[model samples]
Target: MAWLSQYQAIVYGNGANGPILQGGRSVTEQAIISSETRQAPQGKMSALALSALGIVFGDIGTSPLYTFKTVLGTAEMPSDPATVLGALSLVLWTLFVITTVKYVSFAMRVDNDGEGGILALMALLGVKKHHRPSIVAVGLFGAALIYGDGAITPAISVLSALEGVNMATPALQPYVVPAAVVILLALFAIQSRGTAEIGHFFGPIMLVWFVAMAVMGVAGIARHPMVFAALSPSYGLSYLFSHGMTGFLVLGAVFLCVTGAEALYADMGHFGSRPIKLAWFGIVFPSLILNYAGQAALVLEGAPTDGNIFFRLCPEPLLLPLIGLATIATIIASQSIITGAFSMTRQAIQLGWLPRLYIKQTSSEGYGQIYVGVVNWLLMIVTVGLTIVFGKSDNLAAAYGIAVSATMLMTSALLFIAMREIWGWSVWAAGFVAGCFLVVDSAFFLANLTKIAEGGYVPLVLALLIYGVMWIWHRGAAAVSQRMREALIPVDDFMKRTQAAGIPRVPGTAVFLTRAERDIPPVMVWHVKHNRALHEHLFVLRVEIRSVPWVFGEQRLTIEEVAPNFWRAEAHFGFMERPHIPELLAASKSLGCTVDLADVTYYVGHETVIHRDDGMGMPAWQEKFFAVMERNAVHVSDFFSLPNDQVVEIGRQIAI
Candidate 1:
């Protein structure tokens, strides 16, 4: 009731189940986040429940579709009964240790502005001052790793589930690629429709899938009750120590079970953190553990022909139908990854960590549903290629854990920085926790490296390519912007000369959409020099990025009376939020400012960055990268919706 009361202004009465907009706008809340607000309605419970289903449920819900099968497939058909039981035992406990304890119980507590994800964590640790290169590198690397993780998730998730159809009915094997493509295309296609349209069904679908997995696993365990003995921690420990050289290598496959765990945090802003933790502890966790144990028990009693333990868990009579069910579940899991990639890209652009790519919001209130054409088509091509080349989900398994594990390792390393530097947490306490995570993460990383020749090269190459592009763009753009700044006219001199010239005063307000919050834009300085008198109201506005996306309201224009008649208003937007200056200006009647929207002139500064072999310490390759980026960066007028009659563009040139 209190949470609902806080949101009373935004909550309009509903029509059936669809919420109606009232005074302002509403933003959706993700699970596994500790934020104070949820997407309207009732801010607390419903949000938490949906987020729990959306965020944490994706990775684990889909794991039952693949984990046991991949583990046993390593030994080929007629999987060793003893080894199968042992490995399944290993997976069960791994989920308990990694998911239940590390993530659900502890990591969800570390949130930034009610946002949970690697970027939020990085923002919490990042130095606000732009001068800190190490902090910036940490942020970029973390961002790069997330993008890399994004690309791989769809490939593995989709491929693993589709492989089920192949195992269930060998006749369906040839249709796998076509089926996967259709599923993937459908996944991207529905993104424009918004998750809110279908989100209500996600909980029920996941509930059914979990129930099916549990029922299947329970049936297997009934046949071989002794498989429960594998629950002991000693079984996992014994397998690792006893296997000689190959034991270390098995960790690569083992790590796949926890691959989507980070999504639990990354997508936390979409769903609240509480529900995600709840789903894992209450439903997802118990179901996954039971299913894994059942697979192990089935393997111990008798080996299957093709070594697909997951499919084998189902009786032959129902195998095909179950395969169909698993395929649908995996499709949803893959869709979650694709959407996560789009969200991460938007965050990077807003934070100035990435070059602007065209971003389109699909839903008015549901920020999670989005469509980025560039990301969608590119991901489809890469994922389809991976399925064709790897030919099986087990091969993709090696590459899968490496990028995500590295991201987790890097996040933990940065979390240590946050503890000591930002939160002022004790060094010993931070070191102990971070050190343990690092050790676990590193072990997984090394194991995955063994997979490089065995189809692990895909994500590794992808991560490197992504990182290089980001670094180059950052360096090149800085050089170009710096030179442009040097060439611009000073604001003080511009205002003085223009006023002395006795030019006529403008009747309307002039608004400059700026990227910087403090300094006067070069174009503004020039405008004041040329125009003599300021508009009735002058606004030098910049968008300030929050840690989370679309969660906070736009900053109110900070109106200051600079001179008797001159006024300046600054407007800020969160990194995850969009600011429509024109719309905000029109709506300013609530802020006690009356200005006709048609009469107001919006001014934008456009920079043309060039390479002159001069300014800053940039490498030759980086200079080339900047040239490409500058060519690619969208014009300021186009990015911000401003009219042709009222828009003014000032060009400044820079060389890197």
Candidate 2:
């Protein structure tokens, strides 16, 4: 409650969640409030914009590789000037409305302390674990869908790029899938090394790739300027009316053009909104439009509809070189998704939605660069399996749009909540903005649902499994915390009783890591009760991870002396931070706490969970699963970066 009051004052300027404080004063009455106060670092705009091209645009940039080809082949309509023009029109407008206007112009403004994503949006709405179950479930499900996208994006991107080889010679078609598998395996294998060294080249390579796309598009456009007619919305609308169900079904393939739109918002923390927006309007957007237009022009110029349209647009002389570039572009796209998964996993762990895993910070300067072996290998296996199962990008495309469409819908819903809560928008204005996105996202989602029998069920199944895990973890953790809170004794009262009982005091300091800072940890009470002794200097340290990305040094630790030689220290960290107990203790000197880091012995509680048939809040099966997960989770010593030899774990059994 104390921390809640403090956080409220920091976030809302008054200790309340409402838009107005006492005395009839509006929260923003003093000055105009902007969407985001934290600007990107100064003097790095050019460099950051270029970097955004590589990281932020990779997924969407590479979409032109397979989008046109899949649309033409999947749609029941004949590949004529009308159909080609109609499809290209839909593609252009989808990019404009979804990526350019919605995400770039709107969602980027609603961030959690400069971090953007579905999870960040959820946090921005101030939803915590087991609170607002429906909203939290929506955010978690949306985040889970991204993992499904992460798995399928690499498979489809790499396979489609490799399929360009078959365009040169049908004889090499058999090797396409194997080549894609090899490339994907190699991509995942290098994830542990981090991308800091090789990341610099991503911008240059994407620039070259986009330039080539524009040039090739111009060459095709020069042959037939009539493709420009597709710019009109009439062709798209007329095409849909002319052909009833087939026209609507074509949207499933059309959705592929903006599959990576979410990445633009999700990666806003990495490159900032300005740089990402600049890169989008400057390079990525123009190139994609021209390339899609070029593909349409080629189709209208009497090119074969059965062959790959993207590859066929290129001149014969540069076909192999184009394939090489496409491969690199797809690999970069894959890397973006992998890195995103790592970042999301870390956020989930810090927010207590999931258990701790082994996280390695890949770069000291880049807080976004991280590697999680569990997520990496799991994604690799799923991606490779999809490559083998689908066998071609055409089939993988069926599984792709379903997850992204669902995620987009969820984002719109959360954004509606943010507009009302954070932006203090009226219900009517927020509904108008959210309603538009909902219409587009829901249309795409329904269109993709038609492809369920055609491999779209893959991501749905994967998302459900992930959602189940997250929900279980959240519920189990809350239940355990509740049981611990009920059993805990007040620190002051415990100290008084111990002193009155004349317990012997030991020599060195004993640091007990706990969750509830106001109370003596159950492990400490148990230890004192059994041994009838206490440390001369006892510290009950509780680490609280805030929703923001970084915490200042001056506000990192808050120390309070509860009694003589007894202190309760609350250490604050951000979701992006890793805890180093020794370093934190050394920094505690600023708070007037004289802590000997070398001489301190860490005490951590280990819970042995038991599942019973009693009327606890959870089912027996869920309790058993939670017990197993708790048993296998990473130890407190390693998670806190404490020395293993100096760490003592006291076990306690609890029923839930």
Candidate 3:
């Protein structure tokens, strides 16, 4: 209730929408303010930062396992001290500029309410079905590309770690792929049980992993101290000019060091910006730099030129134990991306970009712990298939950076818009900042283009397919909403007309679920037109999803009497909250509505989509696609938590 008061002061105090209130304020303002307030205490901040090391840094943190090797093995680069040092310089600067400066300092600032991600950034820019549809498409495509990254990240990360086994024993080389497949399958299998159970161990384990990286890196540096020269930007610049096109191509591999940079922004909602930043600056960044430097040090110290520099840095006796640790770390890395996919899918459903899936909240305390069976299993199949097809981390690496680069490019564009609109920066100022990121992102994207024939086409094709689905669903939903609006009758006029017609009033209460709060539901009209009967007590209810994470019960529903024995109620819920019809009706009793759960009948509209070629806006193919998606979408009754037995569906056909 006190939170609602704060919400009212911040959201509605500007006379935006006055006191006829449900949830005293807007959810967006509450989320933003609370996110700020949450960062005040030092102890809590440290704990969150430590926790973030496991979840937020897993993808990037595990990069040292393969990044240096991949870069050194790139066809353009010869195995020499100068080339290796140049690649190391690029890796260091890429991590610092892209991960630390771009994401931690800039992109994270452009959150939607308190949430961050490409989609959330689009929401912050006020992208809608009608307004800036192009921007919406871009944002959706960026999100889709992340799923592609999600599939490849686990495959490559686990495979690369498992490959360390081959270094330990030549006899175990045949078992690497099989072993990786097993580990990946087991990881996906346990996803249903939720991460909360094992999450506590993740932080401590990652802490040890980082400490080990620092120690190994220091040991390697002791053998060849000259590798520290790679810290200078001049080495990278000199290599680029000296090698010309060959150096440029090597950037594709160099880009791998920052492939997981988007995860920092995507997972910001789970861990606040401060904590993520702290984790990056405090532990993750230093360990990554040291480990990468160490790998370069080993290469310069005349280690074998076979591209297994990571394991080669270890003493022969510790190699197997190191492989075990690396495998566990990589598994943790895979879990981060899989969990990120689940979170992004939930966000898409809440924002109406995608249809509802059966989302299971796996934890009672953390709203972020969710499981989607479709996403989980689909990722498993694709990841395993990729491992089988690519057969090695080196081959999977080619498919990796393209999606990440494209996503970063989109984020840069969106961040430019946010700077002007949300942060009130001048166009010149915004463009300058965004221009720098655009240059970096575009270079990486173009560099990775040469990899298409090798394996990079995978994520691009996957992104486009997903983009088509989201685009069709968005357009189709708009068309349906438009048709419904065209057929809608004003509630006041409908009430007056029905009363004058002298229709017989039935005994039980009938609740009509509506899209618009002030308009009569089309389903209610159809029910009255055919059945020729009206309930004695009628309620028109609309459920509104707010931009916040939670809403207090006292401010959850607003009820008003529209006519004799008729009422209108608006039930408000945060995007993170689930809606339950019976519970809402019970809460409405406090607002002077007398309702019995057992005697209530709920009315809902079900549309059958028909494809038309007469330029009703959508193409015939897209209309068909939309129809298929609509047919499979989770039913409104199920989404709203209404009992199946108490619900009556009214069917209608709409052509688009």
Candidate 4:
């Protein structure tokens, strides 16, 4: 109830779910987050719950579209009551245990400053890429694997929906891939236009989608009341033990039912845990159960699957309409993961695990409505290629599941740490709780592993490529930063030497962006040494991105006068924040510092990396790899929103 009280005013929230809508990134929350009004409208919970249907459950809600079909194929057995009930039971409990129990109930409680994600969790545990602890490396690798999910989710989701076209007009099967291509292309193209304008419809559309799913499920369940028997745990366990390896392998397909469970926690900061929980239990949970149960019931009645069992649940008259709705729902599901990749990327950039890519703010509605050109296009290419290569949802299913399974396993490992470090849980208690998740997650992961030769290697290869780049960038950047620190001059010594040499003073504020907190930056040393002058007012600004989700009000900027007319200020931003140096500097006047917006010059470093042949640094190839990343990284001026006309780049070559 107290957690419920923190979100009393997130009324009418239909914003997309991801890390991007946390404290600093959301416009809707910004309008209401500052206020402490505890009195909520009577309908607030239900309204927030309704809005959550679109954003929170889009992917998992559509699981029935392909999950049951894939599960039946993997089972390779009869549609007898025993087999059907066993598979149904597995699907039902997997949703309950993994999606509801693991993510919504447990993981959401471990949020960092109310932001939740693999990266945010790493930040919470103080896991840095440079440290390279086993657990830390696992977490980073897990985060990198999600990029593979980003590529595959859209391909599978959209392909599954379009496959329903065959159920209606069998002749149109040839055009399914091309139609999916066009739809996918349109989806990525429209990402630059922002989801704000059409996002409101997402809630109502998903509401209809869920209701249709539940109705279709209930209709089939009515044909056989014994289908409810599958709701018991015994059915699933009996099937697992009786069938042995066959049932074990089926867990791979069953895992698909909880595929998007990560969104429940990742989007927790967007809409609070209360509304997401409400949506799950009140609507999403029941709907998914009914739909999955419905599909199983249809199979049990000896009803032939007309290409797809999910489409078969509908009457002939409604089949086409259902297919159309599935198409839309799948697209929404695709959007969730694509935006999730964008959100993860920004976090990686701020935390130094990634090179700065060109980030475009596609909408003023919310920062969640952002586009990363590199991430978007790469995802597009991978997704389309997967779609074309696989040519059907069934084949794509083999390529899916592994990445998310590994991610969940890594999450369980991190949650164990959070319990001990943050919650102060006893090792025994933490291990017991985390052990259950690990067992389930590991079983799913191992099951999914069998899919590698069946095309699962696609995502694994993508993930490995991403992790390689991340590893190099993080270590490389840290090395460069360390060397730069080593080369910095102590402010007192540098100032005394400059004063003795009678350096000329120019009259304007020169803000030098540096990582140093209390020393003269190398760029500044170069500026004074070569230019032979110093600004009358010099501000050494260090922008720090904290582990939390937000740094607000008085907590954001710390300013001190290290010398007369020479101030050293540290502007703190959360990983979720978009930092604008000028705006923050303008706000510095509030903290007893005078700053002129019009007459300011910004100075930054442009380092060119060169390999050390003696091998004190990284290997020669790694040095070259870092050099290529640096060459393509976004300029510091654009990244910080600095004015181009007033900014200067001081070039320095670092041998690493």
Candidate 5:
């Protein structure tokens, strides 16, 4: 989905600097501010922790429903206590090291102001394309892989949850795929309504899920007390060496346990680190450990390995209810993944890595609750298709951990840079600390790489496609920007020529939207040359999207008079803030340039790119791809929220 991958999407509330125009009236999104959830009052800590359970922990929280079973299935060895204990140990320590110690104890501390995630970290580290491009490409490729992860999450989660039904009764097996498709379709269908009204229930529902998992786990563990030996890291290490390649391959499956750990770091901005930590330590961590142990205990005590061992833990009387609960939990988990995709897409668009699209805000009271039809529908198609193709959670499991493993590996790399540059750590110190993570991440990535032929290519293929779009889009945009700069008009020279030519001034205010931040817009120069006239009050406006989440009102605009009745202006929006020219201009009124919004004429540049066959440019394939993307990108009028009726588009063609 262009919406999802290009979200590679950055999303945010437009602006209170100026409100968004719905049908006609001015409207500001009430609850989309990044800061609102960041600085909660002391009383809201418990509430935030509860909310964090829903948004941050959904993916990992639902892991128990499928993870332990999948791990056992992948190991494909006898279910003796020694093997069971070793697998359990690997799972427990993996949870502790990856989720608890690394993320909760460390990565959460590395925040961009208050936000987290790869992009936020990139912005904080100032990993610009010019300064360090390989690193930027790595960061972007990792971020793009997240979309691959996003695509698989819903399919695997929901499919696994519904598989519990087949666990209860084999006769109903034929219905699982269709039912999952229906559930996924419904989930995507309701995305446009936003999650504000129903989101509040997420935390409470997940809390119940954790409690249920813990209870069932305790019951299972009571049957085989010896299974608790998995707590020792020695057994996990022993398991890895004893089984040779099989143990190493098992690490890939074990990785599924903490695949969602990145979300804790990424979404730390939403609920803050403290609440997330509280939720993990207080509820999620214990629940997961207990549940995985429970599944292992059931197997150790002679439970069948083929049918769902997770459902085996539940008493026959309660099996149906457990199935329903697991299904609901999976849906919640899928929702979080989809919402994340939407958010990342908006970010990618704002940062110039993707073509701009019409981003629809779905909730006034929801946090980053927006929907892209393209992203939603495409994700739905893929998710449903995977359900049909893979057929069983076991088959889909082969595809699950690959993308997230690579993403985590990349995050570890970036974390090393942050330690060196941000924390001013010595290279050796950063290496030692990051090296431990690298061992785990690298092991898991390599292990998962073994599955590429077994459907792991699904996410990798999706990720590569998305990454290709990002790479091509960024390079093409740079070329276009360079071309415009090469052809720019010097303001002083233009002024002298205009005086000599005695150009006539038109009435009212005219706003020319430009890409140049410090140079004269070529579109304006082209306009004067052809039209041979200028507006009495003209503003050369350029919109700048900053590297942070929200750029506040006081710091949003800057204006300077370049010459008589002509102004050079820059409107700065955060990556999380949408750019609306009318509202941006309205904010300029506060800075001494007063103009009536109703009467102002907005002029924008329209580029028609022509691909070149020359050997000097990008490969011919890339040239064509970039041209197609540019041609299909959201028009300048809609991206900047200009008044369509009063807007004029001037066309220019360039070869890239």
Candidate 6:
């Protein structure tokens, strides 16, 4: 068993790097170089647009499935004709201002070197090396919002779609919860199977769904043509100010329609900025607006007064079929948000803002299907818990938009900075755009705050927990490293003592899997002392992960032979990626016979951190968090993908 494990690690080394090693032979020519000279496979703009439209917009696209229904269910959205029209107007205009004008037309153009999303924009704006603390907090909060959304997306999306079944047939209403549970469970259960296999069908299905939404809109539009008047901004403004504080309160829930807009930019790297922009303009935008308008029209024409506005728009004969399609759309929508959460976590891990979690890549072709077992199960528990606690889509709706609105506000702030610093745009230009974004986003954010007593606190509480853990992890890691620096054994002193003792030299390669980017681990010093000789080639590798999701595979790893046999390779991974060191070692060997794995011995350094008055920003409670995290982190040998027999573990003590 031990020999088998050793051989497995050696043979599988670099297999994760994708085909660099086959039949134990290195394929240097086959390797993909991550440079301008290397071009990604191309596709037609139309195909790319359709694909991006489906994958990126599912969450936002399916908002029409329940946003209007949920808003109308609220007490603030009046049953009266005037106020109802006003409320509908507000929803429509909010979509235009926030989703269409602000994000679709403007924000999508502000790319961070062809990368988008909150973190990439932050990086482009130089968030880290400058006003780091404040910007990092903002980024963390933005990240926390995604986590909050992740928990609720499955519950809300699945429940809303399932509610359509009950809408179509009151007989099925009794089975709604059970049906929803099964669908939600199935959605998550397939995550480990990788999305690429089924991913191709996503676009075609969504396109059909959008057409169905548009057709439903056409039906309602014929009945009440005047409902198109909601496109004017005056009604929205009137409703916002006329109804006083109550109208202001409903803005929070109204903001739910655009909860998934950020995802469009976050996933820009996958399908390219142009394709997403085209899809939003050409297909997604019109269908969603029309669907919402159709719902308003249906309500005006005195259609049976059912709660599910979306499914109600379809003809009676097609109700069940529409429910089936809506359920599929909602599942895709939930899948996008869940995958988005995975991407955000990966970015956070790379930027040193998150504790390393076990990340498993579940795809051979598509980068999207990733399973973080810990995150997946935890989110499932939270999602199911929320479903039971809230018990209905309306209750969950109250908690939905608060985190998203806050994150949007943060993105606007970061965008303002990026305009001034990165693009060198004039202050007035940046301020003008920033001010409009702030006004709209701030209204939604403040409105959400009003719902704290009504379930909005869930996400806020979750965000604080997530933020605290991140802050503590960063502080503790820094403190531990600082202590190591102070206690570092100089290379000269160690060799003198080991040589004086006449220790026998070991003739094998020693590999230490380290986490630090700059500092050498304590284990490296000890390994040389105990053996009294260096392997033919000694390496100190640093793996750097970028904050963006879906980094090109070839760009995923950066290897440098910093010194003779002293190589430093920084493995870059998306949050959904799994780390396999043996594969990296094998890949490196293929590049050149710089390090010999046949005679190699892997070394891992294990550290135990003790907390003191450390003066790191943490309170006593957070110190305990650090203790818990240390206990749960993957053990050294297991984490390094090393053979236990050949592996040497060195323990170091540090006080945080």
User: What's the true lDDT of residue 642 in model 1?
Assistant: 54
Tens-place lDDT digits, model 1, residues 235-306:
767777777656677677777788888877765554556656666767777788788888777767775635
Clash pairs detected, candidate 2: none
Model 2: lDDT of residue 529: 79
TM-scores of all predicted structures? 0.87, 0.92, 0.91, 0.94, 0.94, 0.86
Tens-digit lDDT string for candidate 5 (1-656): 33221111112211112122233222124224345456656676776787778788899999887787777777757486777888899999999999998888878989877778887787777854348886777778888888888888998898888888776788898999999999999999988776766776788999999999999999999998888888889988998898888898999889999989989988876667888898999999999999999999999999888878888999999999999999999998999988888778878888788887666765443335577667778888888899899988889889999999998888889899989988999999999999999998999999999999999999989988988899899999888888788787778888888889999988888888887776578888878888999888888988877777666656778898887778889877767666767767777877887555557888888888777667566777887889899888878888777778988888888777
lDDT of 6 by residue, 417-462 (tens): 8778767889999999888999889989999998888899999888
Q: After superposition, how far is residue 602 of candidate 4 from its true place, in Å?
A: 0.8
Best candidate, lDDT-wise? Answer: 4
lDDT (CA) for every model shown?
0.64, 0.80, 0.80, 0.82, 0.80, 0.70
Lowest lDDT block of 10, candidate 1 = 11-20
lDDT of 3 by residue, 348-438 (tens): 7776778777777564434455677888999999999999999999999999899999999999999998899888999999999999999
Ranking by TM-score: 4, 5, 2, 3, 1, 6
Q: Which stretches of model 4 miss by more than 4 angstroms?
A: 1-42, 128-132, 595-598
Q: How many steric clashes between backbone atoms does each model show? A: 16, 0, 0, 0, 14, 8
Q: 3 or 5: which has the higher TM-score?
A: 5
Worst 10 residues of 2 by lDDT: 13-22
Over 4 Å off in model 1, which ranges? 1-47, 75-82, 130-132, 421-424, 487-491, 515-520, 525-536, 546-557, 583-598, 613-617, 641-645
Which portions of model 3 miss their true places by more than 4 Å?
Answer: 1-40, 75-77, 546-559, 571-574, 586-599, 613-617
Tell me the lDDT of model 6 at 526: 67
Candidate 6 clash pair list: 13-582, 13-583, 14-583, 346-575, 538-565, 542-570, 543-570, 543-571
